[model samples]
Target chain A: MSARRRLSLGERLVIAAPYLWIGAFFLAPMLLIAKISVSQSVLARPPYRPIFEPSDSLAAIWAKAQTFSFDAYRALMSDTLYLESYLSSLTIAAVSTLIALIIAYPFALAMARAPERLRPMLIGLAAAPFWTSFLIRVYAWIALLKDDGLINNALMALGLISAPLQMFATTGAVVVGIVYSYLPFMLLPLYAALERQDPSLREAAADLGASPAQVFLRVTLPLSREGVIAGALLVFIPAVGEFVIPDLLGGSETLMIGRTLWNDFFSNHDWPAASAAAIALVAVLMIPLLLWERARLADEDDAR
Target chain B: MSAPLLSIKGVSKKFGAVVALEEVSLDVGAGEFFALLGPSGCGKTTLMRCIAGFESPDAGTISLSVVDLSGVPPYRRPVNMMFQSYALFPHLNVFENIAFGLRRQGGTRDAIDARVGELLAMTQLSAFGHRRIDELSGGQKQRVALARALAPRPKMLLLDEPLAALDRKLREETQFQLKEIQRLTQTSFVIVTHDQDEALALADRIAVMRAGRVEQVAGPMEIYDRPATRFVAGFVGETNFIEGRLDRNGAAALVAEFGRIPCEPGDLPDGARATLSVRPERIGVAREGEGIAGFVENFVFRGETTLLRVRVARDIVLRAAACHGERHAIGDSVRLNFPPGAGTLLAEET
Candidate 1:
């Protein structure tokens, strides 16, 4: 008799939970930041002029909105420092992601191809870095990268160098820090993709007269492409907005937008400019995200 | 097995302490549909892998047409295998998957296309050439795997349980189709399977392996009618095993628990303990005859045929298969006889 269907309360909650969480956390903060990006920076408390007040009438609010300053946006456009910082961040992230991918791919392949009993231990080892404090780990790199640090001492002790290398406070050191910290993020996805593949496929290719190199190029590479893309995105997205690594490792010359945003917020007390920079970084990250989604949907379509 | 296309001699492989294969030797002739049949842990699959060069034997030489392939890698060997999972590339289309081997072997585009197109037609998957591997059905994937493996026209093809994933109906249909393909292509095939019916149906010769050793290697009917060992007798088909002792002389009655059963002691000494391996279908069941009289203790319905367990004496039962139309209830009096040339005398297993 009850032909028409209605979702129960529990069913509705289960379906609505994710959207609610995203709306409350992700979208709301984004909207707040966007609003701040258009406001005028001020020397007074809170560092930015209020676009609207609770006591303002509708007409007063409308007038305030019309006079809202676009100084932060205009500053980002005209200043070569902001432009160079953005470019530097993009280049550094791209370089670090590539380095992490190159280093993690073989390690992941070795773990996946290890004996069955050893796989769990290997995968656990890949995730072992997460157990340690990330801040302490980054600080550890500082000790190694300083002018008279452990690395320079070891090289001198080995008689491989006559003097200490200028490793710390350089762009190379920042790239190294980013690669080291994001290595696991790059490794786990690749391991999953490689491990999920049927070993018989490699054998099948080999049996079909493909050499080891050929099998790797034709079968192994093409199949793990999803993991490659996924791992690249995971490392690139976070590295683009990385704040601590570049700050600790690079000199004042390393112009990353993330450090610029940090200075605008904490040191200079330019909240509007910082919000604008943060919003621009988010916009930059959207390109890779949209491309990732398109690839995933295309894969699903092929499967269908 | 003269001038075999694939010859595996004294092949031995071990996994740590487990002996997967032990000095196994087999020869597959040109155009022969050979099957390695066994239960789990029987090394049939290990032997197949050794032949395909996936797992190298610790000590052996596999020769294809007289070339010793001792340390040849799987890629260097001119042989192909159809995996049980079909293992088709998920990213490639059907035509591309079939053409992969040809491309690896280095051929012109037109030549690879012609070969792939011809194979697609042979497998009746011409319309599905453009379909992605995941988009096709299981049977179509199986055909694609077959076509892909056969693209290079290797000296031999190894199939690892080709129909193990299909249902019974499809398995039977594929059996005939596989045999037809083998015949049409004249390709020597060495298929490994745990299903006896599959081996019996598709193989020209069945090599029954047990515990890392080949127990018997013979034609299907020969293996059924004349099993060389007790393990082969029990494994290949359903049979009624009557344990007994041979009389003082040859060509005499076997003194069993029930009564004196006539049997030929092939090579066993007089007074040697033996077992009369009589196939269920070989025994005749009738209402009255000059055979041993017994009461039907139980009957198992199997489609068109019914297997009747007749007790000739107390605790002495013998299985006899009859047509489903033959109505025989429990406690019905009947006579059973093991016809001549149907029962084989095998020595008791050690």
Candidate 2:
């Protein structure tokens, strides 16, 4: 009876809370960035020209919006720095995501196949890094990868290398840092997908004359595909706009869009250029992800 | 049995301290429909898995057509098992799932297609061959699992309670279809089931197991009419168990208040305690008869035969099945007679 009843006022408000939070915190800020991206930067307290006044009527707001500038977007096309930073950011994130997938797949498989009593401990171990601050974890990589860091010291003491290797302040170091930081992001989804698989399916495949390798390729691999998609997106999307790992570990030449955006915002105080760069970065990342999400949802609909 | 297709000898398996199966041995004849029937934890499934090569026995050997299978892996063995959950691959359509084993064996596309097409027709799933697994009904999914397992045409087919997931009417239909498929394919089938009626209906021979050991292995009629042990008699069908002492000549069992019930005592020593088992239908009930007289206590309606529980003495009620012979109300006087060769005397008590 209660399930069929109409929602009360309190229930309606409770259900609307999450949508309100997203509109206020995420959508409003993103709208602000978009509005600033189309405006000219000025030598004023706000830096960028205000698109509208609070007191402006709808007619007045429409009139003001027509005069908005595309100068920041035009500047972005003329300068190769913006284009190269975007390309580099995409390339680095793609590589790091690929590396994370390779390492996390086997780890998640092993965890899923482990004895039941040991599973809780394995999950806890994977999540332990989240308890520590993310920045501190990235900085800790410096202690391990720097010229006189623990790795170099250990290699030298073991007579494995004649001198310290240039492990830090390189693109390779940045990739390693990102892969390490987001290993859990890739692993949790893959683990969930693999764990949800019915063990009987594997047994049935083998019984149906599938060799072990064939079983993995035909059954295990195909069944765990949803996990692969979720994990790859989780690591790729955030890594595209990452600032701390690239800034802390990468050399000066290893310029990602996040660092370029930061430089435009802080060093040059060009708010319009930084906002435009941020919007472009989101567009570049969201297009592929949204396409994949659309395809995945369609598959689920067909399943029903 | 024409010839033994699969043979298991003195196979023993233990999971830590618990013995899942102990010295279990059996043979499945070629083209014979066999069933391993038991309650949960009775080792029927364990024995089936050992034959399938999913589990290795700790003590003995399993062989197919006289070839030792001690180190043979499941994929290499000529056996396929349809799981209890039906375990159909969700990612593949029905046609692809059936063709999975064939693809692994690596034949031409046309050959695979022909075989899959034949199987689809056999299972009456030709129209649904392209449907996704989730889009199919529960009964349809079960048929898909069966068709997939049978595609490879292994020497022996193992069904692990394959019909348990279906509803009552669907299960009955699937059971008939399963036996039909087995007959058409001429594949040796070893189905494991806990339902006695299912085992009795489908299996050519049944092995009733208990506590990790075989209690009896016989045909359906033999198992019902002539169970070798007390456990088999009690588990297979409804029967009245009467604890009594073996007569001096070991020809009959002397039940205390009900007098001597005639039974073959075999090699059991005279004066030894024995249990007599008599099927309800074996009992003949009439108002005026030369037999034990008791008051009808209760009635249970079973369409063809109505079962009447007759109270002979305090706390002593014997069930008699009447087939449109006589009608008696509760508290009505009735006479019950155990027909000639009607009861089995087992030396052990349940």
Candidate 3:
């Protein structure tokens, strides 16, 4: 009989390969960005280079050694345009997530309460948009929401607007685009959470003499908090870094951090400034992420 | 006679082609502990839902204190239901769960708190008020569910298999506690359960249901002593049936070739074929040469009693339960006897 052998080096490597790949491809790139954020920019034909040469005196090397510098960060904080764009992105993401939640909640509830035969169809309808390319969907929205697009044309033909209303190329258009793109992300989690909720809880609440509205607020909402939080995170996190929807539908009038970062990197060739802005966004995003993680852990503990 | 506190009159319900309940009618007296007992698919749940306004009957009306409940939503009804699964809100602690109903009626926060505290004390869940539903044991969850349902002090309360989730030992203990709580509150309680022992022990009266209709409704003892149908007789307790014909002797009795035995007619028409049912406990067993001779087909020695299956006649088996001290082996000759007034005449098989 063959003896049970210890795991081979090849097997161990296979098991650890995915993590290595992630570290190499994902974490390495991010660390590189962190390194470039503090380094001085060198202007050349390439329009960007590291400031310090390979060889220099110990003191001079120390002085030029990508030593802690807050110049890029200082530029991000003091610049009014960067500050405005950051604030705009935050507000737009927050408002769009909230709006998506409002729309998704009732839709999820209806799907939850629907007959078994109909549930799959309704859930499929909610999920169908996800199969398509998100960029393509945003482009489709641009076509529909533009000033001279189908929406304005139909409204003008119907005399709803005397002239084509300025719907696209604004903050409202950016929010609409974000909400539209991220709605399925909100719906799926909310649906999953609501579906797992036992109907007995609502019945128990009613039996306890709570009205329908009271049941929703007290039992339904609280019980579904995990899903709500998860759905919010799923939408808000991606919407914060969203670039395609705003670019296609929001036009130039909508100033956002994503657009600003894109402009800094590609247009102005300000690699250090772009990296600094990216780091700041990461820091801002981490606060909520940590809090959400703690809440999620607490919820899991409660479940156990 | 005062009017019944709750009356369900000729109520019927249908789900498409399926009949969930049919012509179900009953009255619950004030402070009565009524139970609806049946096997699964017997419409006890449908009837309970109808009373709670979760379901509206397709025909007939339900009234509580002469107030027609037609078109009344569950929230507007002065009734509550304790679901089979207890249905305690997982998100809310016991205190908030019990306080939910009171708060919804616009009660003052102090009033809600006081009532909830009182209920917690009543259900012996005062210390558990801050505990989440999942944190509770099965018995504690049952109590919290009861407290939550009763917190509103509705005119009537409904319990659907309230103790079904508890283990057998805990179930037996909770049955008495449930009865005591109902008595103490004096709120009309209509509990629905398929467990015959649970219904008999907890209910003042049990409505035995079969296939979407009530077969009989009577006090526990009466339902056991005089079943209204063959279904109720078989469903409620063990019985041995002897095929026979009605014997008119001023009083009715079943006359078989073996002997004549007195029995209740049980709505069986005169000259109709019927079977007389005698309880296994009531049938006497004796050794050969002691009484009517029969061969013991099988004997089971239970701790407290010995149950013997005897072939009294060709293809006719008679079950006899004897005290544990008696020993009767299989193939041993035994005798059987039916004590006076023990058998009940059942209607002819359809």
Best by DockQ: 2
- Is 1 or 3 the stronger prediction by TM-score? 1
DockQ of each: 0.78, 0.83, 0.63
Candidate 3 C-alpha lDDT tens digits along A105-204: 9999999889989998998898898889978887887788888999999999998889998888888888998888889889989998999999878876
- Place model 3 in a CAPRI quality band: medium
Give the Cα error of residue B259 in candidate 3, in Å: 3.8
TM-score of each: 0.94, 0.95, 0.93
Compare the candidates by TM-score and give the number of the best one: 2
Q: Supply candidate 3's per-residue lDDT for B160.
A: 92
- For model 1, residues B65-175, the per-residue Cα lDDT tens digits are 999987889988888999999889877899999998999889899999999999999999999999998788788888999999999998889999999988888888888
On the 0 to 100 scale, the lDDT of residue B55 in model 2 is: 90
Model 1 regions lying over 4 Å from their true place: A1-5, A10-20, B248-251, B257-260, B301-305, B323-327
Chain B TM-scores across candidates: 0.97, 0.96, 0.95
After superposing candidate 2 on the true structure, give the runs of residues whose Cα lies further than 4 Å from its correct spot.
A1-7, A50-66, B1-3, B248-256
Model 1 RMSD vs true structure: 2.5
TM-score of 2: 0.95
The sequence of per-residue lDDT tens digits that candidate 3 reaches over residues B107-207 is 78889899999999998988988887888898898898888889889899999988888999999888889889999999999999999999889899999
Q: Which 10 residues in a row give candidate 1 chain B its minimum summed lDDT?
A: B248-257
- What's the i-RMS of each model? 0.9, 0.9, 1.8
Judged by DockQ relative to the true structure, which candidate is superior, 1 or 2?
2
What local lDDT score does residue A184 receive in model 2, on the 0 to 100 scale?
98
